[model samples]
Target: MLKKSVTFVKGIGEEKAKDLHNLGIYSIQDLLEYFPFRYEDYRPKDITEIKHEERVTIQGTIQSESVLRFYGKKKSKISTRVLVGNVLLTAVFFNQHYLKTKLVIGSKVTLTGKWDQHRLSITVNECKFGIGEQNSSYEPVYSVGGKITVKGLKKMINSAMEQYGNQIKEILPPYYLQKYKLIERKDALYKLHYPLNFEDAKKARRRMVYEEFLLFQLKMQAIRKFHRENSGGASINYDKENVTLFLERLPFSLTSAQQRVVDEILKDMATPYRMNRLLQGDVGSGKTVVAAICLYAAVTARFQGALMVPTEILAEQHYHSLKALLEPVGITSELLTGSIKGKKRKELLTRLESGELNIIIGTHALIQDEVQFHKLGLVITDEQHRFGVEQRRTLRNKGLNPDVLFMTATPIPRTLAISIFGDMDVSTIDEMPAGRKPIETYWAKHQMLERVLSFVEKELMKGRQAYVICPLIEESDKLDVQNAIDVHAQLQHYFRDYKVGLMHGRLHSSEKEEVMQQFSNNEVQILVSTTVVEVGVNVPNATIMVIYDAERFGLSQLHQLRGRVGRGDAQSYCVLLADPKSDVGKERMKIMTETNNGFELSQRDLELRGPGDFFGSKQSGLPEFKIADMIHDYRALEVARNDATHLVSSEEFWENSEYKYLVMYLEEQGVLNGEKMD
Candidate 1:
């Protein structure tokens, strides 16, 4: 019944149904779950009690006739004085000329807006022409579009609730409801949409947040259970001596953090269960070398290993580094990127299939259908968030239940990690390598480009390379920001004596690789590029990164771009060449200069830009919670995760009659298909 189409609601026909569908509401259940993003508190407040800039609802009798006046072209304001208690407050409504006729003298009105104590005026957002009931004062705001207005959505929701609210069954067991002191699902829905008071709304939101989080957690746990129980995982023998020898062969020693993460990864690989682990390390934290040590372990255990990265350049970089590190230890490695095609690709594939190639490092080419492994054991993906979930799964499917390890330089906050990566074990390398200097970051206006460049010139004179990054590839009529092409040209002209190479997304893969190689070899002292180099490009000598229009990037991205420099022993610097006009933009610049901690910056970024933009897009697999905020309702998420983990671990809970509805719902959602569960 909950799955019935929303057209069943009164006054909602085929046309209105189409409008609701655009809101991702196809069924009655969706309509109920489509919680309001915010609420307008129309509960009248005492004029004396209201603080300045506080949004409040004030009920008063009209003391004067509204005087409507025309403002700047096509704009008008309706001003009137209303008597609230002993205070005579002025209310102004902008562009609402139609309200002039309604604001008659002596008529009571309830105005909701931001109050200015100094002027004793209210910049009214909405006005009701009466002393309205308290229940009607609390207005829920829904994100509606197309032909649907806020009033229309509210009406439709009210109609749906009137008809089908009773049909809303509780998914949680009675014990959980009592244990958590949660309100009934039906009651929660009603109060959420039409609350009598703010407390009612808060309680209702708490219930909904818990329900959404629990359902999501249960789904995640179910998928994890299905995988762990069904997919027969490989168990590699732990050869500690070989790992120690490999670590000794390295020119540098592993940081304590890296060593700790390595221990966790090795432990997972030694386990019988497939290693679904996420290795989160800040940029320049040496995740690649840790991955190399794991690959070496897999090879020594007589199993082949594969390392997949996001781009060809990173693949090549990893190939060189790993080859230099592992080849001496009898590990035959091969680089197989998309560019390695025709005969060369064929030979690599043949060698890979026959186990002649102990390790194959490549881009998405490693996941191609033709690529096979003789005895695949370990699969490590760098910058794992760059690839979609299906892409990672496809790569893992190539082997016979190969232990999978995902590495990301992006430092996701704990709340996000718990929600998004709850199914996987997470290990964080928080400590940087010893002897590395923190990158000196500065925020400079665009006018200071010459001074910034002069500093870059000094670094180049010392034989150290630098990267000049821009937000756009070319001049964009839509945006007024610096472009890589123009910047490249200007930098090339400015640094006439030195070589300046240009690289952007428009460049061919081979072209990008050639430019990167030149930069690596120091043939190009200054590389002007877009964000293509944001991922992985190891040049120890590159001591400077100058980012133009840095305000165009999120705090996390700016942190990532800054990470490109500061990879070497020498003191590196990052200059954000931006004159941000907005406070948020200026805050981003300020935050960048304030600290080098990626996790702290990411938390702030999440608060400012939100999860959608933080992940680059909505398609980034960050779950869209209707009511539960990963940041605000994090306690609910943690509780839900704990409950879900507990329930999933108990086989009896799956068969218990009390949880039958949950199992049925999960099965219906395809979270626990019959085949996988059985």
Candidate 2:
């Protein structure tokens, strides 16, 4: 049953299967688990029994029908009225002209619409001919789109349940099920959609949510085990003399927080097991220096280290920064990207192969066929969320179980990070370097654009650089976000004396590199672009950031964009150009203006947008839950975490017969590879 395709399900043919696939139902299990988003209680009522503004289904014969059309400037409305029995029923449809023919005189029909007591009439929302039958029991209302309808989904799900309901094996042990007082798996599946009462429906949902949390915890633990038990790790040479020398040569002293994080990384690297660690920090928190320290350790231990980034601009930024930091101590660094080829590329690859280059930095090109390392001991990926799990794993596979360090500037809440990055040890550098001033932030209306532009002009004229950010690359009719193209043209005219540059993702790699270079070299005083600059480009002279349509972005995004300006010793200012009238929009503005703390803003973002499919992609290695909610299921999550932790800590728990289903589940999800377990 688990292996059966969706088309093989009863009542679902090729055409129906195509519709279901578009709705994300591709297998029998997917269909069976496609729980209803809501339930409908259908009860046929007489015309006199209906209440005002209440929906009801009534069966009667249409005595007369006529289409009444009303014209308007924006659009037109069409109304078709049917006199059935002793009630005057009106079917009002907006722009649905085809309904005129569907309602004919002397037609027996069942109409489901809203009853308006004040008007003494019924407004028809849905109509069907021939006095359609109404189900007396509860019905499931699915989320349908495209060529699929709710009725069709109900029919397919009902048919699927009839064939495979009894075939589902129990997931939880009898002891746990009894302790929790949960219902049977098959019964819960049926009751969730077609319950006798609302109480049973709640219980059914509880069952599903519990299972989701349980499996999620186990999957995370399985990944943790895979890294700890099987991955043959590197051993670091903890030479005190060399460490002291490297520290003394630095331009500035490390902060206490930075020094502590460095100590943690060194200790992890010194261990026999592989170090799977994540370094998180707010923008301008000196994370680069900590990473550079680790790279120095790897090179000193006679191993090659590679740093991969998502964009070419960031790769070049790291290349220059690391070189400036490491070259003074006799470590050679080289960069490999897609644009470099022929003799130059071959020479760099040969250096990497012969261990001549101790540190290598590049974008996706580093994972290509020609790039190889002699003794790749450590791998660091910047903006880890930007790359997929497969890409991260592919880079790790280049060496013999290399230690990995994933770094991110986006500050995720501590609890959420622990849960999400359950497979990796986490270290955070929460302190910014000295002499840096906090960026002054302001939330203003669109009417303040003139003043904002004047201030930006003054900043540019002071021999510093600035960035003008827009939400979209091109003009959009649907959204109100400012377009990068339109803004670029406007900025060029406004700042006629300064060099204005335009940038977006549509540009080529070399084109992007050139534009960024121009900006960094102070050739371009003002850059008008999208969020591409949010992650890359280091222009200390760029002290002012102007964001248009600021409400269109989340708090975390606003913080990251704001981080771009305050990198230098000069005071930076972020102008949020927006007129947010709505409550939600106003809240976003308030949060940004109140504080520049990324961790605090991240917590608020999580509260505003719940953790439902927030990190569902394989890039973050976070799974999507159907029936489970983080806020409502927080208690269940804690319970599952403790149980899963206990089970993973004990070796004998994996051999329990009651946990066979869990093992199968983990294996099916590709979280557990038996051959790699031992």
Candidate 3:
């Protein structure tokens, strides 16, 4: 009954159902779970207990006739005096002249507004003709969108609950409910929508939040269990001798941190269980080399490999570098991006399917249906967060239980790792390679643009390249284009003796690649681009980074842009050219100058901004919780995770009669993929 369409409810037809669907409510269960964002206190308050600036609902008798006065054009104020017990106060409603005739002298009225104690005035948010019912104290406010009004949504919810509220099954077993002191599912829903007091409302909210978190964590636990027990792992033999020989031939040695991470990856791959891991490190931490070595290991074990990147430029760079390192050892590799087409693409696919190609590196092209691998044993994705979960799964499905390694230079905090990549084993390369100099960072005011440009000129004269980054205006693409163009034009005019290139999201992929190629080859002495350069665009000779309006970006993003340079041995400098007004903005610049550790910056970013702004909430692979917050409600998350881990690890959870409803619920919630967990 809970799975039934919302149209089954009374007063809801096709039109109303469509409106509700706009708010992500399609089933009776969804409608019930549509929790209120806030509540209005309709309970009358004592006049003496009302503090200044407090939102209070008070009942009183009208003492003065409503006076309607016009202030500015199109603005009106309706004022009336009300006497509650022995205290008198003035109620003012802005632009509500229609209430003048209703609020007559000697009539009773109840007003809900913010109290101004000194002036004895109430700025009325709502006014009733008579005293409100004591039982109807709290009114829930839904975040209604489209054509659905809050009042209409409330009525629909009440109707749905009246019809199917009892049918809603409890997700947790009675034992856990008793342990947590949680109310029944039906009662929680009732109190959530229509509470009698603040305590009841709080308890209901806690119960609902816990349920959501538990269900999500259970899903993650089930996934991990399935991976551990399933016979889907790759049968790879780690060629330690070949891997060591390959690493020894490299121009540079691996850092201790990188070596440790490599050991972890090799160990996971050597096992029979499928390896699901994330390799996160700061910029210039040599993640690419680690991936190359692992790919070589898989290839030497007689299994094919594939590396997917977010961009064609990054893919091409990886192909070139990996080919240089692996080709000498007889590891055949090829690049397959969107641009590779027709005869070349056909030949590449043929070779990949025939097991002739040992490794294939590409962009989204690697996930297409036409691409096939002959015994694909290793799958590595660079800048893993850029791709969606489905995209990654699609690529993995093309291979046979391949050992998957996700690489990202954008360091994520451990807390976030558990929330976002909960099922995967995480390894961090916390140390940069030896002899790599830290990027010198400075924050400069907008007025110092000339000085910053002059410094870049000196770097360019020394045969070094520079990057001038432009801020992305979230409001408009036209504005973004104009900003980048204006900056490019300004830089072009300033440095007439050198070549300047421009790049933005508006540019075609081929065009962007061409501009990047020029910059990489030092043909373009100065590259003026947007956040497009924040990712993998390696130019070792480019030592200068100047970002305009730098405060608009988050700390992680600023760190990413700073990572664009400093790839070279020479001293690199990053100049933040911003005129920030807010204290947070100033603090961001100050923090950037203070430290270059991406992990530390990520934690600070989570605190200063929020989880959403950390890496963009949508792309972070975080669940959209109705009531639970990833940061503020972290304690609840931890408890739920622990409980879920315990439950999923026990065989009784899958087979016991007491947990039948929970198992069924896992299916209903799609946490178990509509199947039994076992």
| Structural similarity to truth (TM-score) of each candidate | 0.93, 0.77, 0.83
Local error of candidate 2 at residue 188 (angstroms) = 2.5
Top lDDT hit? 1
Q: Local error of candidate 3 at 543, Å?
A: 2.6
Ranking by TM-score: 1, 3, 2
Question: How many clashes in each candidate?
Answer: 0, 0, 0
The TM-score measured for candidate 2 stands at: 0.77
Q: What is candidate 1's local distance difference test score?
A: 0.88
Residue 586 in model 3: lDDT:
95
Model 3 whole-model lDDT (C-alpha atoms): 0.87
- Model 3 Cα lDDT, one tens digit per residue, 453-499: 88999998899999888875234645432267778887888899999
Which 10 consecutive positions of candidate 1 have the poorest summed lDDT?
669-678
Q: Output the number of the TM-score-best candidate.
A: 1
- Candidate 3 lDDT score at position 273: 87
201: Cα error in model 1, Å: 1.2
lDDT of each residue in 1-678, candidate 1, tens digit only: 889998878888999999899999999889988888888877778877889899999999999988999978999998999999999989999999988888989998888888999999999988888787555767788998898899889888888888998898887888889998999998999999888778889999999899889888888888888878777898899588988888998999899999999999999899888889899999988898998999999988899999999988888889989999998888999998877778888988999999898999989888788988999999999888778777888888888889999899999998898788877888999988877799999999988888988999999889899999999998999999999989988988899999999999998888999999999999999999999998888898999999998989999999988999888779999999998889999999999999999999999999998888888785556888888889878888999999989998898788888998878868887977633321
lDDT of candidates 1 onward, in order: 0.88, 0.82, 0.87
